[model samples]
Target: MVKVLLILLVIYSFSYGKIITGNWSDPVTPIMADYVKRLIHKAETENAEAVILTIDTPGGLDTAMRDVIKTFMGTDIPVIVYVYPPGARAASAGAIITISADIAAMAPSTNIGSASPVQMGGRDIEETMKKKVINDMVAFVKGIAKDKGRNEEVIVKMVTESLNLTAEEAQKQKVIDVIAENINDLINKVDGKKIEKNGKEIVLNLKDREIKKVEKSLKEKILTILTNPTVAYLLLMIGFYGIFFELYNPGSLIPGILGTISLLLALYSLNIISINWLGLLLILAGILFFILEVVTPTFGALAISGVIAILFGSIILIDPDSPYGDIPLQIIIPVVLFSALFFISIAYLGLKAQRRKTPTGSEGMIGMIGKAETDIDPEGKVFVSGELWNAYSDEPIKKGEKVKVISMEGLQLKVERVKDGSKI
Candidate 1:
């Protein structure tokens, strides 16, 4: 595709910035990191003038952000990060990635900052730990700013105090290199810039060049949705519910299959979210309790405990600060209530089925009454429920006399003559 685009670039010879763009509209994840890494690699391989990554995100995992920054820094081609369109932000890890790029740019109405390292649920770090975290981040951002030749003074405050700056303020403070109105403005301004990469300085010479976009891979696309907090959590619950339904109604086929699929998807997503393993274990245990409730009819005791366990597990399962935010109470509450109700209903059904009389099995005829088709002193042939059975009577019975089925051993039924004409 790049080759084809390059051919067009040569053929058309339209004079402008030869830009290869990557959109970072999603929260940073391992998948996003890989996507950007490949983007840069492709840009370098194709010898493009520069690579521009337009970032628009609230925040995401720190590790994923760092990985993306590492990729941008290692590339030989000039990498540019732009916060574009109206009302976009380069918050948290986005700010870090922006500063790490060779050239940082932002459009009007955009903002950047808020690099504080909070937990998944937006809980701040405790006293001693928070100080340490802030200091470490200060030192880290300071280093990144120094290496990239951007301002570190404001960045330090950004991490410690969650300072946010508009595009104009960022440019004025040297937090970013350019403040453009849009992508076209960015392309025009960066046309004559020179940057040193891998000990070699390259002139951008971007004017009159074609722009190409880097598309995401299939794996990246699927993983992107899995990183969403709401989606991942839903998948997790659906997975458990599916499997639970299957277990309650064994051999139903559909429920189990759906549950397996949903669960696997949830697991894959949770892996990216970096959820607490213990929380996940607790959730699984709670689900087991629910299953036990159905199997043993524990009078709702197990189901109640299961609900508690699931609620707690879900609350702490995901860190509030994770790209996948803490599982919302709305989701957890409904899921728990639904799960409990389902388990209780299923238990009731199981007990009811147990109490129901057998309609057509060996036990069905235990107390059925039939007339003796043939009789002997102690043996006869009896007709019961439309079937003839060999019979043994404890007392003598005459042919055509009604007999009560007392028991059965193999094909023979133990019976006796009806005493008071009791109806079957």
Candidate 2:
């Protein structure tokens, strides 16, 4: 019984010092949220001393940021958020995350702060709205700072006024606990440090421990790609052009099918992100107007309105606070103008083709003078434009009477006697 007890103690010791490292660099998507939850679960199951979250992000969705904060608040594992790699930062939502951690640390040259919340769209909010948002964010940050034993006043300033600080200053002000040059040093400094988590005492034992990396899954990769502004923009254009190509050519299956797929993907992305619904509707309306102009040739009026709508819609399609905000105005303006020109050009060509006279076969031979090779009352053969055509005439004519082709009816040509006696 003594030997068995000793063995159990040894096993518990071996399981008590696990370190789980999580690297988060982007806005927290649902998949990212799940991944973090799984990591937390793994750490708890393995009896981890602490969970280290390596953060390097500009910001992300407010809801996702809140989700991460909720996870941290509920977890038993002591979460240490470390902003590493010298030049990294914890801006926007990252600031909230860093302040919420059990132990915050940063590498030399790294910075953190700037937690002001703005409207998702680029438009500025009213003064009252701004005050409300700032006050709420202040309360949130103050709570996290209080829980982490950091300076709540400084944290409030960081959120409301976008204050920035270097790692050294952060450590000096107790905003962070330590400023390590690298991960190795961080581990050494944190090892054997007693931390209370959920009212239980645990000591870190991270000396010489192996580091494991958790990667995003394939589905997450696809989501990241779709969320990209450039890719989403391209998809929208491809969808519009695909449908347009199908409409112009009627029976081409490839363009139509591809366009439908692209448009659906674009729509799916827009739906997932926090997009201005009005902007989306305006873009759809623009496309419809352009298509109508193509069908009915609206002398640039529809084209002009369509261009304006498309420009406004594209500019406002995705939330400005989102990653999509990186899309340049230069790109947007040129693409909108070019797209409008392309539509107009196609419409002009179609209208021109419709108004032009026929240039092929018997239908093209109308108004050409021809000689009657055989003559009768209303049915005979005539040579017109160097081709023999079945002919009909209201006037009586001799065998070689000169006749002018007036019109074509199926395979027959209707003709009248030429003013001159010459056979044509």
Candidate 3:
């Protein structure tokens, strides 16, 4: 009677319960870590049968990644991390995460490994420090692998030698439990797998369970966009352009205000992206060079160099190994080309404006030719630039005689004779 009752209870629990799942597709940011932690917490609170995380990431910040691993370690629920879909990979921090899960599984066409930490953001680590970093990672991964009953030596190779493994090979080597083609298949394979989690052994009741996905909240969606490398890069460009336009044409309140707002937004992103000071300096230098090109004649030399500098700086701005560093080449190419064209256009326009006839102020009268409307020995009324003004000349001015404005004083134009309708 007790056995039948137990079986009936299990059936009831499977029939009317939630099987929680989450898809982590972004580079592992702190926010991503938080998201996963929340999902785990929610699952635990609701007495979920299991939590399946479908992960596809190129890796991300080390601190955030470790925090996620820590959360997995502390969670009472069985956390099954699956590297899913074809052609997907669990790389860098991702590899560690998969290995650390209570049950690590992968799809047929997926891969795992490549957890080696490369120098990002700045220059290469000093030799002594590099050894220390590698040792630390090796120790950390080895510990996780040991606890998870994964092959520690081979896992060490992932960090030391940057080794990668196909899903089939991984399953054969016991790195992953199974190579499931889909969630249903995965459930069948891992249905009764006993795993140790949260200081106790628990069975993953994957059979016939309802899969409930924890969708990202609106805040997380916005946060994801803000931390995106491409989005941040574009924001940075917008900020630069806005400020440049405002500076170029001062008192244009709209551009200045817009620039300030964009800059603040960009700065917020940069903070999240983790600013590399050297990279930031290089970007600033590039802008300075472009501004100097507009002010001084450098034959487009400064402009070209500035574009190159900005391109290189932006490339190195985010850590190369981090998710933020992987801005596509397609984006970089267009941005560089656009920046060069913009600077050249702005500089050309600025120089042209300098050479143009002045429209107002004392210097505006120079080279302006007009007809004298009233006769005078040294002063007269003259029409120039569509406006009549009092004028003076070293030479006598006569009525209806064409006069060339050579200078201006106190709203009066200094004139020279325009004999034969041409200034002599």
- Best-fitting candidate, measured by lDDT? 1
State the displacement of the C-alpha of residue 168, model 3, in Å, after optimal TM-score superposition: 1.1
TM-score of 2: 0.59
Q: In terms of TM-score, which candidate is stronger, 1 or 2?
A: 1
Model 1's alpha-carbon lDDT is 0.81
- Provide C-alpha RMSD values for all models, in order: 11.0, 12.2, 12.0
Ranked by lDDT, the better of candidates 2 and 3 is 3
Q: Give all TM-scores, in the order shown.
A: 0.61, 0.59, 0.60
Q: Rate the local accuracy (lDDT) of all candidates.
A: 0.81, 0.76, 0.78
Candidate ordering by lDDT (highest first): 1, 3, 2
Best prediction by TM-score? 1
- Candidate 2 regions exceeding 4 Å error are 1-17, 28-31, 121-123, 247-250, 271-424
